[model samples]
Target: MAQSSRRSSISGPSQHNALVSQNQVVLYNASSKGLTVNYIHPACHTVEEPDASTCPYCHRPLDEYNHSAPQAPTSDHRAPNYFHLLAIHNESTSRPLTPPHLEDEARPPLSSETMAEGYFDAFFREESKLGMGANGSVFLCQHVLDGNLLGRFAVKKIAVGSSHKYLVRILKEVRLLETLRHPNIITYHHSWLEPCRFSTFGPSVPTLFILMQWAEGGSLDDFIAQRRGISHGDTYQNSASPESEEAHMTKAQRIAAFKARTGAGASGTSRPANLKAVHLLSTDEIVSLLWDITSGLAFLHNRSILHLDLKPGNVLLTWDPNVLIPRGMLSDFGAARDMLHQGSRTGVTGTLEYTSPEIIMPDPMTGALRQTDSKSDIWSLGIILHKLIFFHTPWRNGNDDFSLLEQEVIAYPGFIPDPSITSACSRRGLPTELLTLLQSLLDRAPGRRPSCEKILLAIEEHK
Candidate 1:
């Protein structure tokens, strides 16, 4: 039997079957007005095929057409005007066909303007609160299209306030996100400005809503906490409501809690006695996670952008059914800065624990605080690597004490884990190359630390 290779299947015999059965080429122009049957248009035939006969309808002779040319069908036509050469095959031969509507998959992503306030509420249904931060909250949402569940997404709602500076900052982050396109980086979908609903900044203020790809496995911070059997408290709770736990607390209570969490009022750094790592990652798993992070950091550094905050909390994870461990992707660019256009401001930037020594302590030569650069990120990466291996940072004091942390960074030597931690690493079969890379990255002098490119090479070697 003969069939139109790229068109609808022929179920029963028709008047065109005579030509089709002979394995001859045929073109049918399907239009809104009517069907031009048994006509081979000049535009439809190619030089590779045998010469086609003249079109009986218009009396126009067939001309050689480059079928591979990048030309789309005219909009007035209901379907394709040209068809491929008919081929003869057995009637019993069966093959699955793709539906025509599936072509819509190639359409470009929806624009932010098209997804303004009402459009978002109509398509996305909020499932649960993923996490809450000081200025923003993320929610897990189910995206629906024509009554069909498409997939899950993460919607980040940040309070913009009435200040122009805050609004510009949010817009800047959106622009930064739009320019980024890497597998290890979080994918940005859509963003829009809407009236603030949950903000304490009054109803007149606007909120910036950013739609991002959902990371099913959660953040690395939560992942590590879970593996170590550590409770993340309300801030990291997946089931916490949109209203934060501290929302109802009095101003004084909030301040007191913040002080305790930051180790501000505490005498010195101390780990909870009950803290223990129950499920530890193997050497291969550690290398794989670090490789993803290093690749992402390299991509950013190559473009002259710096991820000021490189803590585990900013690194999201997604699991693949085929892979054993979750894949890490860099997210949350709120603190990211473009060194090209922006001037460096020296203040405490990013989380206290993961911050670089140069950003914390004054320069020994000039007694002046230095601005953060790419090397600062390397120091933070070293901290993350140490955490992945030992399930805790190298610091003896707790993370929140900035004054003690400054002292710790100033007196920091090379990688020196506790005896118990050393034993744990030995049992995990940690590689010598990784330890070498870690030591180099943790160099107290910013000039001494390796670049992201060097770190990537070392990670590749470990792999």
Candidate 2:
């Protein structure tokens, strides 16, 4: 008797239905290698880039289909070659390659059981208060399980109920940081939600706890102050003209100031304040730091992420005291968000001093502040670099109030480094290359700012 054949069918949504469908069939040939047969719907044409829908012709969805069909038995046929049959089988039913572990799935959601574990209690215990901000309080916490006393971390505990928007912001920050892994960016260890009640608030609210690497030296603001020294002599010479003072500083003085301020004192060639500081930063170190930051920005931008709050405080030192160069990491993603598909209307979400002009200025026609974009981050970075080189913000002395400050930012978009500082550095004048980079980044129009990659390349080529 002739051998019988087995057939299988797959089912999926019809094209007429709101959801479309597709299907594929595999046939096992008794005398030869297997084959794949696709039965696509006529109406549902497969475009190069197809949206989520079923095949219009067959009314079957792509995912729903019978993957296998038995071969017909043939009495007179010789058996198929084993190797060819295996190859054909493999080709017909190959599975999609799995993505990298990091991209596998949304981080497993934090469970209430996990939250109730000692993780929260231990993190909050003996939390030496570090600082406080609009969002929450920062504390220096010890790692409970590791028993690494010196391995301190910063814990940011944000109380819920302020606003759902703020809660969403915190969640977004956690999500972004959890996936990012870079030396120049702060690391996110873990997070948990704790239920608590407050007397003033009346009802209890969920408090979110975020753990991060602790910056021992505190903010760059404090670091700069320490480098300049507390005495009047260490202060920028107010009496001398900016140009004249820069000219008078010796190489030793410049180097000492740079070392003292940046904490780049590894060479051990200590000289008195008379000589200019030998900017220990080789052309490479400066380039490296710039590259590091831009790379970080590029990563964020590629993922449609925006670090709305970009400032010196958000850029932290990585605690490398041995190296004779300024090494830092970026932190504080509390205000970051996805900008790929949506306009960011979150009003004025960054530091006042470093915010872009577009954010500060309201559109006259719409009577609303223009939304912030990746260019807003570039503008903020430009201001940050300006402060590093000049030791002051462009809008610092010009205004006493927010309104006046916004006016100043609009009027003078470029920051001219103090000539005094430039003149004082004997090894070289103010980093003109960095200044130019900053100017371009600070452009009022978002469209004009260079992409992060371009900025990184410019910094690398800076003389």
Candidate 3:
């Protein structure tokens, strides 16, 4: 996998450093520096290149960002490969995005219409708050189409202050979400900006409203926390004949029951630190979700993008009444970047626990951390897999000291689960092959780590 450069040459503010929001409208202006002025980026900048040469947004000359041959899977769906599944799902479910010039003909001017009649009342009806953060809040909303409630969507409302750099970062995220289509990745719906006050007495700022597909099952971390309650002698064990009680229940019902006991809800909550142990997910479910996550990662890699942050919190779960397990979809791309044009790191990015050693470990000679690549993401995936099977990370500093954690991770020697976890894996029928894969994913040498494609191949072979 060769590295890809950032398509957009303009540097923007990142959500990590500035207030930001997520929404679904494309408005690009060549002169406007702030997001308040409707600077829409051309969708072509994020995805595979099109035939036209001029920039659709700025009417400036265009240059090819990616010259490499496309890495899309074969059209033959008859093959039993995991890539085929992703290809089929993407083709069937993802809508063809309209080009910038043809945007008016493709869809109604909903952006203007919503702005005329208050965004929430005219377009979507707000339901409940899903999650809130320093810069923005995500809400569960019902899409009001033709005077009837359609489907639920997660709308992220971000307060975009007067910062050109942050505006650019938000644009990068929106452009990526708008064009990147995959079943295991959250779908972008619509986005537009409106001025709203962050507080009652405070002045209003440009709040970006990003509409996206709602994952009903919350996040993977939420799922794990509820499962931990079950392991801690919660309702499942306390019930009279728990096995018989749940024999006819659906996956949603089982999870709901667990949530009721654990005080979990649609918006995820952190697991209590007191809960020292957690119930391990079944091997089948783990493998299935692994396939979902790896498939999404593989698609991004194919596009020459690196998901620098791949952790449980960033993986949302979508539940179906008929399906036995919830599907994992990758979310939160604030830390992701185009691997092809990546530059030297100013500081380490991503969650400390899941960040690869190559990114966090200092050089022996220069005493500076090395640049990361696709393999750095594989190490994060390995940590996720470890938490899935053992209910905890393989290595920890047990404190908030970054240096200590970095040192511990550098010396980790690739973890093999203890007897208790191995015994659980045995009872759950986890294949030894998977354990081998997990260890290899955490290999200290990034070059030795398996690519997402290789991981999917291993899964297909085992299946």
Error of 3 at 201 (Å): 3.2
User: Residue 275 error for model 3, in Å?
Assistant: 10
lDDT (10s digit) by residue, model 3, range 157-200: 88765544555567577778767767788876556555567688
Give residue 210's lDDT in candidate 3 (0 to 100).
Answer: 75
The most accurate candidate by lDDT is: 3
Task: State the TM-score for model 2.
Answer: 0.58
lDDT of 1 at 178: 60
Candidate scoring better on lDDT of 2 and 3: 3
Candidate 2 lDDT, tens digit per residue, 393-439? 66533223667666767786465445654464334544567656777
Candidate 3 — which residues are off by over 4 angstroms?
Answer: 1-117, 145-147, 230-278, 398-401, 417-424
TM-score for each predicted model, relative to the true structure? 0.64, 0.58, 0.65
Regions of candidate 1 where Cα sits further than 4 Å from its true position? 1-115, 199-204, 231-277, 363-368, 417-424
- Compared with the true structure, what per-residue lDDT tens digits does model 1 show for residues 1-463? 2221222122122212112211222332222211122433444344443423332233333221213322211111111111111111111121111111212333443233222344445456889999888768999998543343445789998875444466566667777886676768887655655554774764634567777778988899888777767666634332222123344468787777656644565653544565545687788889999998988898899999999899888999988557898888899888898878867475677887788767877668987667667998999999899878767776655554567766876677857444654665677787666777888888877788898887777788767
What is the TM-score of candidate 3?
0.65
